[model samples]
Target: MATTFENLLYDLDAATGILTLTVNRPNKLNALNATTIAELGQAIAQARQDGAVRGILLTGSGEKAFVAGADIAELAQLSGPAAQEAAARGQAVFREFETSPKPVVAAVNGFALGGGCELAMACHIRVAAEHARFGQPEVNLGLLPGYGGTQRLVQLVGKGKALELLLTADQVKADEALRLGLANHVVP
Candidate 1:
């Protein structure tokens, strides 16, 4: 069966009990735009509903990033209601992945910031490359993470660490992330 999606940047392949989902917008550093988010939500929902897919591996197209963050341009134009809707959509999509019966693994290559870090946390496991960096820098942009970051960060890394990271808005290296139990494994 062929899958339909609005964003060509995302590539989904189901095979051998694994549904491999790739964020294909390398030129944009695999940023999560609205269309990409919608497609990802649909793809993940389809995978959850499909009996053939036992596992999901989410990664980026190139070596740059798993997902840098949300599309800043799109986010830059949102008002109060529009921003709320956007956050709700992102939460719903990430929640779908989080609650899925099948396991989801994030193969984080490089920058997994803001919503990207939240996305990784929503997954069952995360495997980061040696160079991978993680953070929630939304505060720097005069905003906070709208995609379950506030809660999930606390759950994953504890209140103190979560607070520190969120307040400072600094990126953590792969080893540091692993040390804090943020990332499961670090690949060379």
Candidate 2:
């Protein structure tokens, strides 16, 4: 059975013991708006307490992106403390995934930029599709990755590569992501 949400599809597989959480905002390239993030936190919390769920598989709804990024429209309105609070909330929710006792794996089917990339890094493992692209393009927006992207990208890909990616705001293709150790596997 699947739990209903406005922004997510939360389904638990009894046979596999894996809870699959799909971000369902393809029109926005599955962007993480505040509502979606809150729903994700709620679903993850339920999965954590559910004995039936042994692990989690996170992904997006469409072929274009696992999650494109944070909702830029929502972002455009914030400044100072408001922006800080939003980032802090996002960070806390992502932290839950990072500290989950049950394994959380990201199925990176497409673009995982900004907060999307951070979400993938929070997972215990990331499996990318052949066309998946990863980056921290926050620099272009005059913002830094606010969801542990700096630390996790460095941990996954090494300081030199991480710095280059962060500074340049360039996207890494699937094969390159695998080479950089940002992705565990790339499937065709």
**Which candidate tops lDDT?**
2
lDDT digits (tens) for residues 1-188 of candidate 2:
78999999998999999999999999999999999999989988998899999999999999999999999999998888988998998898999999999999999999999999999999999999999999999999888999889999999999999999999999999999999999999999
lDDT of 2: 0.95
Candidate 1 matches the true fold with a TM-score of 0.94
Q: Estimate candidate 1's RMSD in Å.
A: 1.6
TM-score of 2: 0.98
Q: Could you tell me every candidate's TM-score relative to the true structure?
A: 0.94, 0.98
lDDT agreement with native, every candidate: 0.89, 0.95
Question: Which portions of model 2 show Cα errors greater than 4 Å?
Answer: none
